[model samples]
Target chain A: MLRPPYEIVLKPYGKALVELARERTDIICLSGDLTRQTETDLFRDALPDRFINVGMAEANMIGIAGGLARAGHTVFVNTFGVFCTRRCYDQVAMAIAYPNLDVKIVGFMPGLSSPGGPSHQAIDDVALMRALPNMTVVDLADAVEISQAVRAVVERRGPVYLRLKRGEIPVVSEASRRFSLHEAQVAKKGREACIVASGMMVPAALVAADVLDANGVSTCVINSPVIKPLDAATIVAAARGARAVVTAENHSVIGGLGSAVAEALAEAGVGVPLRRIGVADVFAESGSREYLFDRYNLGVQNIVDAAWITIAPTKPVPAAPAMPLTAGTYAPV
Target chain B: MQKRARLNGKSPGGCGDGRLRAGAPAPVRVGDLARLATRIRLHAVHMVGIQGFGYLGQALSAAEIFAALYGGGLMRPGWDRFCLSPAHYAVVHYAAAAEVGLLHPEALKSYGRDGTELEAISTERTPLLDLTCGSLAQVISGAIGFALASRYAKDDRRVFALLSDGEMEEGQTWEAAMFAAHHALDRLAVVIDANNSQVDGQVNSVTTLEPLADKWRAFGWRALEVDGHDADALVASMQSTASERKPLVVIGRTQILGGLKSVPATADGHFLKLDPALKAAVIAELEARLA
Candidate 1:
């Protein structure tokens, strides 16, 4: 029996969470009154005793989750994107992140995956969580990564802010190594240009790679599961011979994965001309995910457009601050 | 900035010779705590003198309460956790730490200077401090987390939160208050110094936080009231036990500038450059009380 290539079912992610909760009694699910929307209600229903509905209070939920985590429970915090990042910034920063507790903030509806407009969407969550110290951030690229993400964060110590996606999503990186939190996978390797992406944009980058491959201009696609503590070595290696680099993500291009990739390249002294293909620094209107993606130039077409511009024939550039880019001595660029 | 936001009390008209009042002695019923409170008040006065300004009035008001917590057996240097919110009250905490010998006696000299750990508000960099708080009302939740953690580890230790009347204006306080009660965190005790003073003027004038006792009670807490300046009552009430199903809170009612002996009768002392004569007088009065 061949499993469908694209699974549109949102049940798997919630079901995975419930399964994890069932196996570990210490895993407590805390909801900011968004259980149904975030799909944490599965855990709430499965483990009623361990679930807490904190009632539309993001900060209090974080603080409560912090206490619960301190009490020896693996707490999973769920809420809308905006509320988790902006509304509860202080509690998340001070109570959870500052103490370096073992709490997981599972923020649902990453980027434009909502029709509820800017208020409900969390387009900058990745950037916000990445800025904080001790915060491990991961935005899922596929539905299959859901269970893997659940296990990865539970096994790791310290606080984590995971951007989760529900609804039907394709499995772009099927054979990727079981989802290591800090490892980036080279899904396709041709080296015309390296297209770095994480979360929802992983699929788009893959499609873009396909488009570039058909044009006789090979493109390398790297799926970065963990945005923070990013796989620096793999990124530099992936961009070793590529003409230029292009970054794609389902987030604002300002400070999300695109910025991160750029920083890694600059430090590695790649000096590869780069184009960040994601949402520009602007407030997107309320619409479906597909509409926003096309409108914001984050569609497969946009990735291909960026790839052509990056890998187009051009003059050679000087290497950035020629230091031996090795682990032992990470010198400044 | 949230700093200097606490609605302060007016400068009291009477800077009476509050030095134990001779025959009308101070509340000495709590053993050596009176001297400890006096020492804390004196050190704070010195700090005020050094900076020529500070949260002098709030420190003076809550001296005995700090004595009751830090001086008594309810809280100690390394055994239990004490969270001082609003962070501006570091002088009082440092004084209490010095009294208990957790801090070096000479370390109090760099109270508000740069490059020193002695920040205007208490932070984790300070030795023997557990919670770092400068932003208001957030420490209560952190304290709640600490208490919850202690219980989770099955440790016998308790967590105490020292807040101000002004912090009640923060919504997180109420959320944490209700959360502590809902979780039945018996190992936590929150004490609010109802000094009726803040940065703007009177706290009531800034925002009505009256009926505070009933508010806590409604949130499913074991609420109690006591004379914040009476070390005996404050210590006695804090020592009272609570079942594992409920949390405890004590409202220590106190006068903002009542612990000191002298001031420019017109100076509220909330945050002021102390007059040279008044500085000498405050130190002398606290010295006489200690004597």
Candidate 2:
């Protein structure tokens, strides 16, 4: 599912939400004045009556979302990942999460995907959301997952923090493959090493698996969309037999996919050599996704090298060349 | 101003779900509401005195506002929603709810106990408060949501949010004020208990928020200033919402422990520590007022 000539879907999340709202009258969409940028403009245009532009007040927007949810409407709060999570975390925790309201906080531009630097990048959103009780944290890997996830979260009760990448989203998976909130999809299976990754890093992890396979290191890749309520069984099973386990994410290695997988492995008693590929604990600078990912050591080669290090400790793994990216080209599985 | 005048002429009909207790007298006039306010204070004294220390000042200051809201029947139990923005004021809310029959009087005994619904600072588990996050200045935003949702459902039920003067210090309160006015949520009303009291001393000393009504007016709301201790004024001001297109903000000027004179002026109203002697004096003072 992860290869070049990758089909790009424009505003799949916004369109999917609009379609969902057409049938579900209980759905209400609120935006913190980033409607067009967050793709909530589609929902605003389609369902003008149900759409509320709450200006730039993120805290009030979250509170209003909570109130709407309390009034028996499932609310979709849309804004940048940074604004929705870190900016209004208290409101999200108190107003929405504490009561376990049915408010879907849609945070666009996850991790280093935003060139808007530290203020705009939501590098620690998963950690923040995961810390809150009754908060379902989801980081969709592709357009297919995003489209399916919008409906999947609404079906389940309680609050959800869904992180999405804005603009042209890559469709890594088929429409037939359903998105599950409780499960992880094993994209590739191998015997020697396993690469557990989520969101933007999933594609890179897939490409890294291919590179490892070619280098005579058979690697398995697991695509985890749900960061919280992690499919630990699938991860632990894959790690149980593998010689090396590598977890990758588009977030800091501190409290996201890497930490979650590490916790799962430790609790499950699956003692395997593991490597994490992500942003080292530091505030990121403004740059393109490609520049930031590579600069932060989150490229495909980084994942391949990390996987190799787990298996061969003392020897320095051979430096692999960076993968070339073209228009509509996302690293594939 | 004319709308305010017109509302003052006729007493609000207790048309909402009868909020008074089963045996309690129905509040029919200004005097009835005033007496109800005193009863609310007495109930609060009982609850807070049981805990030795609690947010007694909030109850004392917001007594009349709650009486007009709950006892005077401004809020319907199942129909309308009430948001207690200041979580610490849960003591006052629980007392008022007990005073009205929304909660049993015996249930007030469990106030602030571990594993009890009546938390010292209200959480989601707290009874009676429709939306409370155990944080100050945040619940008003949720009240705006309720008002917006009610508008969508075509339900004419109103939402009343009780806020502390200190909450104005928070930026989110003004954000919610701006949103409510922009949307013209007429059914939503906010009662600011400008009790001039907070944990860090007087609200004015900490954050100089003078000309509070003007601030709300600037933010596009129909601002009404009234003696917060005057239950008639609160009921009248809240009832005047029928003609208003914009959201209403009733700035009720009040004093901590205003209705009671037993506590010294220098005493902190935020959290009152009732020694056995002070507790007896407070109860005696409130009991005489109730009589």
Which is the leading candidate under DockQ?
Answer: 2
Which of the numbered candidates is closest to the native, going by highest lDDT? 2
Chain A structural similarity (TM-score) per candidate? 0.90, 0.97
Off by over 4 Å in 1: A1-5, A8-26, A69-73, A310-333, B1-30, B76-80, B113-115, B150-157, B240-246, B265-270
- Prediction 2 global C-alpha lDDT: 0.83
lDDT of 2 by residue, A203-282 (tens): 88887888788778888999999989899999999989889999999998989999999999999999898888888999
Tens-place lDDT digits, model 1, residues A72-191 = 567888887789897889888876786677788988788887788889778899999999998998988476677678888888888898887755545544545478887888878877
- Candidate 2 on B1-291: residue-level lDDT in tens? 001011000111111122222332333233488888888888888888886888888899999998888877576665577788888888878877776666888888888888887788987666656776667889889889878877886766788898989988989998999999999998989998999888889988988898899999999999999999999889989888446599998999999986577898888899988777888898898788767
Model 2 docking category = acceptable
